[model samples]
Target: MKILTIDTGTTNTRITLWRDGKAVSVAATQVGVRDTAITGSRSKLDEAVRDTIAAALEKGRTTADDVDLVLASGMITSNVGLHEIPHVLAPAGIADLARGMESELLPHIFSKPIWFVPGVRNDVENIGLHNCEEMDMMRGEEVEVMGLIERLSLRGPAMLIMPGSHSKFVCIDENNQITGCVTTLSGELLHIITHNTILADSLDRDFATEINPEMLLAGAELAKRIGLGRACFNVRTLDQFTIYQRNDRANFLLGAVLGADLLTLKNSNAIRMRPGIDVIIAGKPILKQALALLVQNDDYFSGDVTVVPDDLQPQLAGLGAIAVARARKLVTP
Candidate 1:
């Protein structure tokens, strides 16, 4: 089976062609739903998806008609995407997502109605000021969780940490269902603070490429004891009082925010975490390393922490899409 998977985030879109199980070729573009949100039009998003799919098909040496299945996930199912699909309630598994899948055709992209995988949300029935913080949602990470579980043969109850623009902490039940998720915008917040804040000059307007264990541990520990805001201010003090390089200072800042996120996961009501459960952190090297190091150094969930490398990130969503498609039996060999 030839499967094409499309993942559209807030600022980028990726399309991959998969034959059976392995990825064949991919086409990505810088444009995504952000353009739609900025201009209040979907024209750019539509063109980008169309062109990207064509490029992927061409690069894979296959025509659009030869493809048997096309699946989409991520913000592409949000209101700003090509089409909006409702979210499935949490406690969802591969079968739940497969059953929740919605099929729709956008003649501009493909001849077949692409199967849209529904995102997941916490089961908070009514929104109120008293219990507002207990609600969270995810666009594309659930599918990745399912794929990672099968890919790594993980047993639950496990906590999956996916770091990106919006980092997601997903908790899977013992039955391998996604029970709930906690979302944070620390990645985007770090970007905004680095370029737009007073600490820009002190820490330098850049992110850490390498792991500085001391600075990272220091920031995380400080954040644990004090608040995140005050811990961030310490970055400036580190640059002035200490002889650390700008890169190390940036790592300190990285640690502060991610450390705060770790604290959130531990103390969050959005998802209930059990002690000694398995924790998996997956993302770029910088995030993966920082989180793994924090888990080692700190009094984190007392669970076994698994760190996924950066090399396998490119095909995660594709593996997920293919796996869920087969589960639904939407298209069979």
Candidate 2:
């Protein structure tokens, strides 16, 4: 089966074509659900998606008729996207995710069927006492996690960490089921603190260049020593003391924020106790910082840490797998 998957996120949209369990073609654009929904008209969003799909089909050398199935995940199913599909509760497996998918015909774009996969939700009960039973929801990362499990042939419990504007830590069991998940606003918070606050003036450096690993590790260690509250202020203090260069300051800031995130995860009772934990860090093009922190803070987790660069294959595999499961009548709606 030829499957096309569209993964729309907060700032970008990606389309990947899959055949026989591999990605044949992939395309990406800056038009995300949030980027196109300025007017609140569903028609406008649909039109944008149609245009992207048209472009992708041309680039992939495949017409609409050539595709057997079209699957969409990420914020595309949000209230601001094409439509809002309610989230499927956690402990979800392929069958649960497949059953939650909603199909619709876009005659304006193609005759082929399009399915929107619903997001996954985990209630507060599974997260432990500090949360007091609040709910967490994710749209795009679940599909990637599912695909990674199958591609990596991971048959045991594993922790999948997807870092982005908002990060997700998903836990899967031996049965290849999502047992629970946690979301952190660390990325967003970092942006706000560095770009929107007065602290921005203290650090002016190009982030595209290679980050200093030493400064990054030092920042992580500093956060661990004094906690984030004081560590955040330490960035400014370093500026006053002229202790670090401009680029070094930026690296320190990155380390401090990532360190705080690691500290929170390390302190979590659920994370500390998970058996035979295998860590997979996906997404985020620059992974040196995250990997360093993970390796440095080995006290919280004792397992192999694998880094998988963010690509189009995992999303394609995930969408295709769910579609196959549905086609075989393995999932109930």
> Using lDDT as the measure, which candidate wins?
1
Clashes of 1: 0
Model 1 global lDDT (CA atoms, 0 to 1) = 0.88
- Per-candidate count of clashing residue pairs (backbone under 3 Å): 0, 0
Q: lDDT per prediction?
A: 0.88, 0.71
lDDT of the structure predicted as candidate 2: 0.71
Q: Which digits, one per residue and each the tens of the lDDT, describe model 1 over residues 1-333?
A: 888999998999999998877799999999988999999999999999999999999999999889888999988999999889889999899899999899998998788889999899999977898877899999889889877887888778899999888999999988899999999998998898788888889866888879999988888888888988898988888888988899889888888898998888888899987768888989988889898898777664688888986666667877787788889996573
* lDDT score for residue 113 of model 1: 84
Compose the digit string of candidate 2's lDDT tens values, residues 1-333.
Answer: 677788888778777776664577777777777655675566655666777787778877888888877888889889887767988887887778878888877787557667888888874454556764345678877777777766667675777777777877788878877777777787787777777776777865234245677877787788889887677777788889876877777777778778777765655543332534877777766644455454545576787777775554456335544553454463332
Candidate 1: residue 46 Cα off by (Å): 0.8
